[model samples]
Target chain A: MFLNLFLLLAAVLCAFQAIRARQMLAAALWLACTSAIVAWLLYALGAQEVAVIELSVGAGLVTILFVFGITIAGEEIQEVGSLVPWAVAGGIALALIGLVAWFVLPAQEASTAVSEPSFSVMVWENRGLDMLVQIGLIFAGVLGILGILAEKETAEEQARASQKTPTSTPPLPQPQVITTDAHQDTPIKEAHA
Target chain B: MSSELTITAVTVLCLLGVALYGLLIVRNLFQVIIALQILVKGALIALVLAGKISGQINLGQSLAVTVIVADTIVAVVGLALAVQVKRYTGSLDVKNLSTLRR
Candidate 1:
């Protein structure tokens, strides 16, 4: 009971910091901490597989990606001061919604019928297609991200080539593709501009 | 007072509300992303609680795994897009990009 309360308190505090911290980098770190705590909460609640994945991907990989975002963009935008107004307004609004939901939502009852199925049946037979589709979705998402990043890199290379190859003086053949995207459109551009 | 009453689920849902408020009001891309992550966490907690109550732990685990996968995918693609946006616009501020047409 005390552990659950402690987890709840930790989660709330971290969530606030994650949302309201002035520096994006700081916010990202706070978010990582929040993810770690949530994973712990899941573990305590007996959702071991969920907790492990949350620990690794949510806390681990996402945090790394967020740090990369900060480094790449590297523009520091300070947080707006004073959480009072936002907090009060948000809390009140949420409370009102919850009040409404409590009455409107149907009461759920725990199933009294306990038919024990083996873990293998639950996983392989019942959930095979579900897992298969999820794997495919994640795989496709990864490929999409890679393709997007690659496109940006090639665009940068083309822009550089355009810069180096001068026209008229040497009469080098006109480059085929136009300005890869825009000199002004990317993070590297921020450095030069 | 009943053990069957899901007070914990309510608490988790309240946390989701807090995260949702942040998501709605915040313009900072990173903060919004954090808010979104919190929201996902809240949902995962609620799912676990529901499964526990319904005596369907395996079903809940399976659903939680799906949510985790979806959350990861969104986190990745969303951050990448945010980076791409920053690259083109030279600012991380979401309001700065006003174009409706591609």
Candidate 2:
């Protein structure tokens, strides 16, 4: 019981930090902590598969992504303060969620029965295609990001190459100053004068 | 009423609530991500707890695993996007990201 409470408190604290932390990196860390706690709770509750998934994906991979994002874009996260109204809004939202959960979740989940927890079934069942689609979504996201990050000059080069209309604006000839003996003699005469 | 179960469930729920609250309140992208992770964990725990309460074994576990996989992919993509956005915008603040049209 004490352990559960401790975990719960840790989860809450981490969650609060994630939400209220000014630094994106900090938030990501807090989120990872939260994920870890959840995984632990799952294990404690006898849901080993869930715990593994949460630990591997949520706590490990997702957190890494957040950190990577922070490192790649900007290392600093700015603080914005507007508390009263936000708090009020949040309170209302929480109340609504609580009400909904109280009324709905139990009833909906009551039908869950004891079935063999087969990994293959979970992976390749009707929902297997969903995973593939999700992967496709990630691929599209990567492509889109790459497209956005491509330098303007490369894009221009591509355009020029594709157009195949080479304009004959001859590259400017290298500057040449021919110095004849006559010119040297004049400079010498001027120096003497 | 198993005191252990009750205490664990309530505590976990509270923590999850706190994390969700943080996610909603924090302004930093990193913090938001952190809070999101916490919220996800909380939800996973809640599912597991529900399973325990009902004496069901793996249903909740399967869902938790799915969430984990989804979170991983999402994080990878999110990080990639963050890096690209930083390179493009020179800042990580979510407020600065106005170029995303959708």
Candidate 3:
């Protein structure tokens, strides 16, 4: 009972934070949290395989990707936009949420009949192709990173520019000094005396 | 209430939810990543709990292994992005990243 309450509270908290946050990064975080909670709920519902995928792909990889994209693309806000659009969007979303909740409430609590192999075996062994596709997706991501880090003609251009620049001042010439004996100067001084 | 696994599963879900919320609401990229980590952990917990309830060792082990891989993938990607952000903007705050904004 307590755990259930905690889950409920966490879900509520994540939703509230996601809705109220103004920053894009913050919104992304809240979204990740929401997905995580849903993943856990899925597990509790006995869909362990689905839960793992949800957590890994949705919460972990997706969140990082989102942050990466946001950072790469820049998430800065130049101005505070009007709230009119926000209100409309919120209203529509809330209405849809209410409708879905009402529709699913009856079946939401209904326990699924536990199968022999369960959903786990089905996703893993039966859907190996999907897993292969997922691996490909990861490989694509790595390639994308490599593409970003690849240095192009920019470095060469910089080097050429430095080579072409002229020197501001000529190098200082070395000073030449003739060595004179101190004893010779003393003899001249004595003759003068 | 019914079983330890069930209770744990529910708790994990709630934690995941909270982490997601944090990820969405926080403006700081670091905070978002942290929230994402929490969310991932919650999901892992849920998977493990389900494995326990079902009495299937193979499913649980495989699921755990996959989750770990996913975790590593996310961490690597997230670190790379974080470094890139720092390199470009000199700050991790998303609000400061308006160079590409139209």
Model 2, residue A103: C-alpha shift (Å): 3.4
* Highest TM-score scorer: 1
Index of the highest-lDDT prediction: 1
lDDT of 2 by residue, A1-193 (tens): 7777777677777776667666566767767777788778777777777677767777776766666666666667465564336777578557755864575344333345565546557656745775676677667767765765575458567888867865677545555545567646542222211
Model 1, residue A117: displacement in angstroms? 2.9
Residue A81 displacement (Å), model 2: 2.0
Question: DockQ order of candidates, best first?
Answer: 1, 2, 3
Q: Rate the local accuracy (lDDT) of all candidates.
A: 0.76, 0.63, 0.58
Q: Write the per-residue lDDT of candidate 2 for residues B18-97, one digit (tens) a residue.
A: 65566555545555555555556656676666666665645555555566656555555556665655655666567667
Number of the top DockQ candidate: 1
Docking class of 2: acceptable
Query: How close to the true structure is residue B37 of candidate 2, measured as C-alpha lDDT?
Result: 57
Best-to-worst order by lDDT is: 1, 2, 3
Residue B68, model 2, lDDT: 62
- List DockQ, one per candidate, in order: 0.47, 0.44, 0.12
Stretches off by above 4 angstroms in model 3 are A1-124, A151-193, B1-3, B47-71, B100-102
